[model samples]
Target: MSMDAPTFRVGVVVERRPSKSPWVDHAWRIVAIIPEAIGTEPGHVLGHDGEAVLLYAGARSVEFHRVETGNYRDNLTSGSPGLWVTLALTDEEPGIRLISVTADPAEGESLTEIGDLMVEIAPMPPEIAERLAAFVETHHVERVFTKRKRQ
Candidate 1:
């Protein structure tokens, strides 16, 4: 996607398991107007600033949730009272399209390719969401350090 400010609602999804349930659930949502990036990178560094999403079941209402790309280790060290990973972002769509990590659709699925970045969405609070949206709105990505040379 382009670097310009996003005009559509960004949907954030996170992987979760209910306290009393065994199966995992990707239950989180951060519907906001902001800029998001998709590129090649080892692992993923979810947020631009310190802001991100924290997708759990009942901590907050759906309107306040968010998600970004990250791993388990990131969650433990996130420093937030209850740190969570914000995996991926997408425009408003129906029936958990390819963007929905829980949907677990196959490769070449409907979603656009995000290069080496695996979808690692997480959930967050409203305060953090505002910070993230602002950061993403103005940040410029550098690819010189990310390029691999052909031998």
Candidate 2:
């Protein structure tokens, strides 16, 4: 088995809006994933639609593991394959940071289960989906599963 893993870099575009709930001041949501990185400041505002401000939080990598090619293929065939984005906040940065993005639903859900990081999913762009499909094609290996008898 090869240890090589392919990664795709994406700009995590976040939507920042005033929170209606009193518990928090602002509500942050992952709105989109730019398939390619735009060489701009992380906190640069891309647009505001009166309801929310869109900002480029930071760049994150979507890594494809050789062993998880099956999951990637499942995601692509799920009819609504998505790019999952994970965001986190820290005292070091004083703002949200793009931690990770993945095409594998299981990994994405595991990150969401962490309970601290904010996770969101957006429809995967056709181009990126194609690239992922190609990666799956190149790295995917079929394994036979055998059920074990209980003692």
Computed on alpha carbons, the lDDT of every model, listed in order, comes to 0.31, 0.82
- What's the TM-score of every candidate structure? 0.19, 0.87
Q: Write the per-residue lDDT of candidate 2 for residues 1-151, one digit (tens) a residue.
A: 2357777678778888888998766788877778565678788888998988988888877777888988999999999999888888655432677788888899889998887798888789888899889888988999999999999
lDDT of 1 by residue, 52-149 (tens): 33332112111211222122223323553122222332333221222232211222132335553234334444544454445433443432457778
- Name the weakest run of 10 consecutive residues (lDDT summed) in model 1: 57-66
Error of 2 at 68 (Å): 0.4
Global lDDT of model 1 = 0.31
Model 1 off-target regions past 4 Å?
A: 1-82, 85-122, 142-151
Cα deviation of 130 in candidate 2 (Å)?
A: 0.2
lDDT at 27, model 2: 88
